[model samples]
Target: MNPELAVLYAKLDIYGEALQTIKHESGAVCPNFMTCTCPPCRASYGSWALASEAIEKATKLSQSASQPEKPMSVCTKDEPD
Candidate 1:
C-alpha cells in the first residue's frame, strides 16, 4: 500500500493493471518527490526494481505463449548463380 510502489507499477508496460490496483489502494502521489533524498526515495528505488522484475517475467511468459512452434525458413540452393 505504498505510493512509491504504486508509481513504479504504473510505469511498467506489462504491469499497468498492477499500477491501477496500487492507485486504487493509495490515492496519493508517491512520497519520493523528484528532489527527495530520504529513506522513502530509497524505498521507491527498491519498489521500481521489483516492478521491473515482474514486467520482465510477464513479458517472457507472453512471448513464449505467442511464439510459433516452427520457425519460418527460406531455401535458395537452386537460385541464381
Candidate 2:
C-alpha cells in the first residue's frame, strides 16, 4: 500500500471515531430542550466537512489501489531475448 494512502486511512479512522464519540454525547442530551454550546459539538461541526472530504479521497484512492497493474516487461523488443 502507498504511504500517502496509509496516512489518509489513519486520518479517516481518527475522524470517524471522533464523529462517533460526538454523536453519542450529543444524543445524550436533547438539542430541542436546550441550546448546546459544547466544545464537542463545535469541533464536530467544524471538522465534519473536512472529514467527509477525507473519506471521499480515501475511497477513491483505495478503489484505484485495488486495480491490477500490467506486468512489466523484463526485456524490450530492441534487447535480445
Give me candidate 1's TM-score against the actual structure. Answer: 0.43
The residue-by-residue lDDT of candidate 1 on 9-33, one tens digit each, is 7666546667444434432235543
Off by over 4 Å in 2: 1-45, 70-81
State each model's CA lDDT, in order.
0.61, 0.63
Q: Residue by residue across 1-81, what tens digits does model 2's lDDT show?
A: 999999998987887677655434443333432335676655555555455566567679989999999798786558658
Q: Lowest-scoring 10 consecutive residues by lDDT in candidate 2?
A: 26-35
Off by over 4 Å in 1: 1-16, 20-37, 71-81
Model 1 is weakest, by summed lDDT over 10 consecutive residues, at 20-29
